[model samples]
Target: MNRITTAIAVLVLSTAAGCGTSRSATGGAREGNGTVTGIITLADEVGPKTGDFCAGLDVRVTPTGAPEEALGNRTVRVSRGRCSYQIANLPSGGEQLAFTVKPSPAWQCGNGATPTLAPEPQALQLKDYQTETRDFRVSCTAPSAETSTSTSTP
Candidate 1:
């Protein structure tokens, strides 16, 4: 009985010691999933616009060079003014990701102008356990008079 108790104690101590060591001590650092978060803002030629200008818009994050059924694609809708979004559980290790904003087809600026995302789609490199921010600015500009004018014949 004494020998058995001694063996059990040794086993428990070894397990505890193993658990306390840092991941780097055993080998290289452990790879972990990463996250992407950011805010979406609505703007016009004058300045930033408030209220529901951002509502119903979507922000999407997709892994580049990934398979068709890859797991990293994510999309979130803007819920309010200065909307924020987060895409988690993305596989890390310096993977490239594409971030884009999608505006509703029926949505338009307060001045009856079309809105567009500035800087276009963004590309980012994600690292292990890292959080990346990619903010989006949706700018609305009224069409020029020439573009909106109607032609008349005598």
Candidate 2:
């Protein structure tokens, strides 16, 4: 009797543990994909200083979410002060998309302080066959760090 009771309890527990709801809070494992595209400006005052805004600039895309399996980090080179980026074939899930822009030492792309992502990471829920648009900006002013006479070369 003891052995039978233990076996029944084990089975019941196992069955209960294995049970899962048919619906997911965020609508689990969906089909289809989505895309995100945008552009970034180097800045009004900084464009001329750099001569070529498209010369030395890069933008990176980072995805933060669960086992998306479709999302990944993407890096793009800015051209003529414009950044057109796209992230496609994404699984239906929650994602915090982030963008960061950096310029080469030769070319300055930020204000007196430093360059930063205009719009921080955004929380978005991607739907099947959906496309989203986001635009970024990079501006600048007189170099702050270089104001001093510290002409130290890296």
Q: What is the C-alpha RMSD of each candidate to the true structure, in Å?
A: 8.3, 11.7
Please name the candidate that would achieve the greatest TM-score relative to the true structure.
1
Looking at model 1, the pairs that clash are none
Query: In candidate 2, what are the lDDT values of residues 1-154, reduced to their tens digit?
Result: 9999999999998888777645333344433366666766656544444344454555444445433333432445455546556655545455454434455445444454455556654556666577777777665545555474565678
Cα lDDT of model 1 by residue, 33-110, tens digit: 777887777664523344554446666555565323223435454465566777776657876666556765545677
**Candidate 1 TM-score, C-alpha based:** 0.58
For model 1, the superposed segments whose C-alpha errors exceed 4 Å read 1-32, 44-55, 65-80, 144-146, 150-154
The Cα error of candidate 1 at residue 115, in Å, is 0.6
Error of 1 at 100 (Å): 1.7
Instruction: Provide the global lDDT of candidate 2 against the true structure.
Output: 0.55
Q: What is the lDDT for 32 in model 2? A: 33
* CA lDDT scores, all candidates in order: 0.64, 0.55
